[model samples]
Target chain A: MNATLTLTKLDVLRVRRNTRYLILAIAMPAVLYIAVGNSTKQTSGVEFKAYYMLAMATYGAFAGALMNNAARISTERKTGWTRQLQLTPLPGGGYVFSKIVASLVTTIPSVVVVFVLGGTVFHVHMDAWKWVVIALVLWLTSMVFVSLAVAIGYRFDPDATQPAVMLVFFPMAILGGLWFPLEGTLEKIGKWFPTYQAHKLGTDIISTGRISMESVGIIAGWAVVFAALAVVSYRSAQEQ
Target chain B: MSPDTRTPNGAVVEFENVSKTFASPKGPVHAVNGLSMSMQAGQTIAFLGPNGAGKSTSLNMLLGLSRPDSGRVALFGGSASDAIKRGMVGAMLQSGGLMSEVTVREQVQLWAKLHPRPIPVAEALKRANIADLADRRVDKLSGGQQQRVQFAMAIIGDSPLIVLDEPTTGMDVENRQAFWATMRERALEGKTVLFATHYLDEADQFAERVIVINKGRLLADGTAAQIKASAGAKRLSFRLPGVADADLYRLPNLVHVERQADVVRLQTSDSDATLYALLDAGYRPADIEIQALGLEQAFLAITAEDNNHGAGAGAGTGIGNLEAAR
Candidate 1:
């Protein structure tokens, strides 16, 4: 087997066994979907239930990916496991790539639970292709936050990562309009954020059959920037 | 020996005039001076040093975790990084790096998969003497068992060169013995082994060659017997009721004298001459006793020198003084 594949498998195995991560990624989103998503009525010429469901699902996927990756990386950094891996044939790039893949794998449960709840209970109506597009867009855009999570892992000690994740994640979740509907100046600010773009892309696909090229471009741009930062941080992390 | 004195072949590890300095809160600290040494394939070498004696710094260079400020560190005729990429070296660092949540088996298996041709997981566990604890979580294990797990991780690869730093730190007497037995088994398979240890007796019992360092400078490079041969003084004591301490101190090459009741003890550079002088002084040879110092005392006496190697000239002079003092 390829080295990266082996690493990915090991990472997946470890991530699956982490109960705290599973709860954080899946249960929190499920509870949020049930609590806030139940009372929403139609708004903005779209069913409010569907809009809030898509927004929360996108938030769950993005937050799950970032927090899981950051927690793993920061723990490894604290334990000096990163330095131990450096003594092996495993390349730095391979280790980071494995973390990204693990983050993506772990976040799937969050997205699935949200979608299942939304479709079964709320009766979110959409074509098969629309559903696939929304899921795919959300999953793909979550990669942007994966890199940002990696940067956080490299920049801070393990103890600081939990607060750092909360500090960065909640504001983005709020400003990105995952909770309440964006309006006025808040919506204007949220327009430039990747989380807002991702949620809009998912909800837009459900409302309208067409996809936005501008949103795709913006998400890709953020992914590239985060990827660059991750690389820089990983290289200089130990020096600091 | 000088760097130029190294053998041309079969030298699996080499350090040529390597020096490293680190910037500390107190100023620049020289962790390793211009030190040179090499180990042949199948050689088990022990690096002996006191605290802050550059042992860990040198091992870090060999493991490619840190680069030397000057000169080169090579393994298998290539740079340390190249050798590491080729999966030729396995190491057990002093810091405990195992994941607390993972079982011993899972951790060892993960590390085994990282190498190109790792040994069997079962075999690694058995050799490291942790097979019974394989199913146990790392955090639940005692400190000695965790050290054994770390050892298992290091040897799982079956690499040609094995480097360990203070590998037996938390081990009990039984575990320590088992650890060295496993190390001996690996060496018998023609693997090159280098370990840094504070236990001079462990070095004497296990290592074929010992390298002593102090104040970031190379103090002595020889076998245990050879290092012991370099000790400054040996004690020659006798139950002489009438021999005065001043008379024993007057013996040639005598460094110090002690008197306790009816016995007189003389510390001398040349025990034979001192004994003959004492015999000539009318003390019968039957009452005299000479005691050879162990490696521990010899190590302490050698490294306690005030030889500070400041410039490039200092290291050579310090080592030279070491040899002369011997």
Candidate 2:
């Protein structure tokens, strides 16, 4: 097998082995959608089920990607497996890119599981394009989480990875209004967050049926910033 | 084993006046300084050094993990990185390099994937004597078992050069013996092997050429017999009822003499001549035993001299003086 496929297989196996992480990533969003989102009838001229389905899917994507990728990197770093890989024929760029792809792939199940729960259990109605857009938006915006995970994996020690991830993921989810629609001070604060902008891109597709260029730009800007940080962190870690 | 005396024909690995220094809170630590050596293809060399002797640093430089502050290191007639990129060198570092989550089979397979041409995973596992444990999780394996898994990973690529830093650190007596048995087979297959080890016996028994380093300095580089010969003395211990230490020192070829209780010990360049002279002088010695010093004693003497010389010069002393001794 090729290096890319082989590495992806290894990572996918790891993801499959850690079923607890997958359950947590998938279940939290679904439970939040059912309990908090089930009672609501409508929001901003959109059905509550549809609006919050995007919210739950956004939360699941970000959580799943960061949880698995960042944790895996931290474990690899602690074990010095990354250093071992450096001595191999695999190029550094290929290792990083493979890891990114692997992490993205691992999180795909979370988006799918949550969306399926939304459509089947919550009985949300949407056009096929709407489903495609929400999935695409969730996947694309989750790149920010991938870069963030890479940075965290390099910067933090293994013992601190879980708490550090929790510290970042929970705050980002809450601030982005992924649990419910933001209003007043929460909305004002949430508007500045990259997650909020990303989540907004998904919800706007349903509420207005129109793409938001400003939100896309904001998400892209955040991704660029995090990607730069990831590079810097990875380099500095290698020096140690 | 006798020194092969066949110098490796092609230089597969070379270090040219390499120097590296690290900054610590106390001051700058010169880890390796102006070191030069080369390994010929098919040569199994043991790189021996005391703790903090810069063996790992030298190996790291040769492996391309760290760049030297000065000089150059080449593998397979090119840069170390290029050789590694070509999959010509396989290395097993001291520790912290194995992943704990995967099964032994998966770990080895993962490493195999990194190389352009890797040996069959089953072949590597069997060679390392871990075929039975291939399905076991790495975290569940013992330290020795994990080491074999690492060994499997290192040789999985069928690389021409294999470098191991203290490969037997955690292995038991039987395991270490088995490990060298595998290594000997590799050496017979014409693989150039370099390993750093604290076991002098391993160097004496396995390595055709031994390189000794102390405090970032190359102390000695030769076969084991040559190293022992360079110490230039044999120890002759005997019970001489009435012999004075002064009389023993006065004998020709005797370098030093000591008396403890009723026994006298002689350090001599020529044990035969010294014994003949002592017997001729009418010294009736009992329980006499002449011993040629081994590599361990030679290594201690060499490093001891370094310590004494380094003490007077303080911390800034480089490997300049030791090169003459080699």
Candidate 3:
């Protein structure tokens, strides 16, 4: 356990040092929110600033969950770092366990950064408990992408993982209404993505004090599918 | 009785009829086939084999990186994973990878913290000769520099059993010397060291025991001199003009028969028997000379014999070709 934690710490430190992760998962969302926070637009029955704040926070968490881990996991396997760890005192599943823990830890910074920007500079207000709940909802639902990252990392090589992540990233960010509020055909399609549902869960909490079963069901369904993919790919990679 | 008789007291490593077959488009490749061997504590063993001769596959099974198809690979009288979880083994694999984005110091430090009882990180770094590159990012270093960093990580745990696969592959002469010196220090401390290397001379000088495998089976296992002896210890040459190839091939214990015109060279397990057979045949060959074979020549002779004899055919011959010196 100590060894796994040490690996976890090292992994977190490595992610923190990655400039690409910072630019994509942390800076981009915060910058985008600041540029569009004060628009005269309403989304999901909440103030434009508050809704956009939730969307950007979800954006940060979602992107943070996917980008760093996918590239790092694929690269580690290719380089034999995973095999190196297996020869250690660390137990089975220790490498993947540490990676997941590190991914969770690294995503915290983005969530906090976006939330603070929204609550302070953008003047979006909410109850203390509401802030905590919304943050938890967005962060927890982003785990779908964490599992997806693991799947992609195991399925592709390091060079391919970048394009693979980008393939998922653009569709989720745009179709999920993270960059802007979606309506008509876009909303109908985007409502099914975990990212869109997670953002809706947060906005509906602020506006209606409740989230729909459909939103919860969509996130949970995607979570199961991605988690299954992660397990299958992880096992296959180990066998090889 | 003693947790299986094969694991005698103080056996640091053991392989019992283990086999592993990998399936490819070409068909199933038997990477390891019923290979069995064991090592005692404090012995420095060199594992030698040709390319695709199951050296890496066996190492992987021993390190618990992959499972054997049949039988068992035991480390310290238990499973490989068990021994590893106890931090009883430290290995530097040929394909084992180093972490990027971390400095050499940080990388070695992380390795030390992962084991049960690790030596000081500074001691490991200095011994591996990477102390000067401590702050340099691992991915930014040269291939040789990265190999040194791996060496440091392998020794950081100070485990009782150390396994190194081609530990000095990218090293210069001086660095190779230093690397062997540190390995000698480890051996002197009563640790069991198993290494596979391409430098046959290093094995001749460093290994207290040499084990050679070919085509997924134990070909030869003994001291370097003993293996040389097994593969016809001496080379005998004589100018026997007009000597029939059949006549030379008839020599007792003949390992190889080579002829260059009137000059006949015979590698024989027993030089005396081979020479007397020629003389006994009423042939007084002029300028008779017998020369001892080096480990390299002996290795070539033995493995070549096996290759010509076929994979399973060499089972009776035990014959390690060690073409790439394992």
Using DockQ as the measure, which candidate wins?
3
Model 3 scores what on Cα lDDT? 0.87
Q: Give the candidate number with the greatest lDDT.
A: 3
Please write out the lDDT profile of model 1 over residues B101-190, one tens digit for every residue: 678998898888889889999999998899999888886898788889889988988888899998898899998998999999999988
CAPRI category for model 1: medium
Between candidates 1 and 2, the DockQ winner: 2
Better of 1 and 3 by lDDT: 3
lDDT tens digits, residues B1-326, model 3? 12332256778888999999999897788889999999998899999877778999999999988899999888888888888988888999878899888999999999999998899999999999999999999999999999999999999998888999999998999999999999999999988899998888899899999998888889899999999888887999999888888888888988888889999888888999999999999899999999998876777677767777783543333234343233
Q: State the TM-score of the second chain for every model.
A: 0.83, 0.84, 0.88
Candidates ranked by lDDT, best first? 3, 2, 1
Clashes of 3: 2
lDDT of 2: 0.81
* Predicted candidate 2 versus true structure: per-residue lDDT over B118-210, tens digit per residue: 989999998898999989988789888988888998899888889998888778998799889999999998888899887778989999999
Q: List, residue by residue over A1-240, the lDDT tens digit for candidate 3.
A: 888899899989888888888998899989988898976676679889998888888888888888778888898899998889888898788888888888888888788898899888878777888888888888788788989999999999999999999998889888888888999999999998888899999998888778789999999999999999999999898878
How many angstroms is residue B56 displaced in model 1 relative to the true structure, after the best TM-score fit? 0.8
Positional deviation of B167 in candidate 2, in angstroms? 0.9
Write down the TM-score of every candidate. 0.88, 0.89, 0.90
Comparing 2 with 3 on DockQ, the higher-scoring candidate is 3
Inter-residue clash pairs, candidate 2: none
- Candidate 3 TM-score restricted to chain A: 0.96
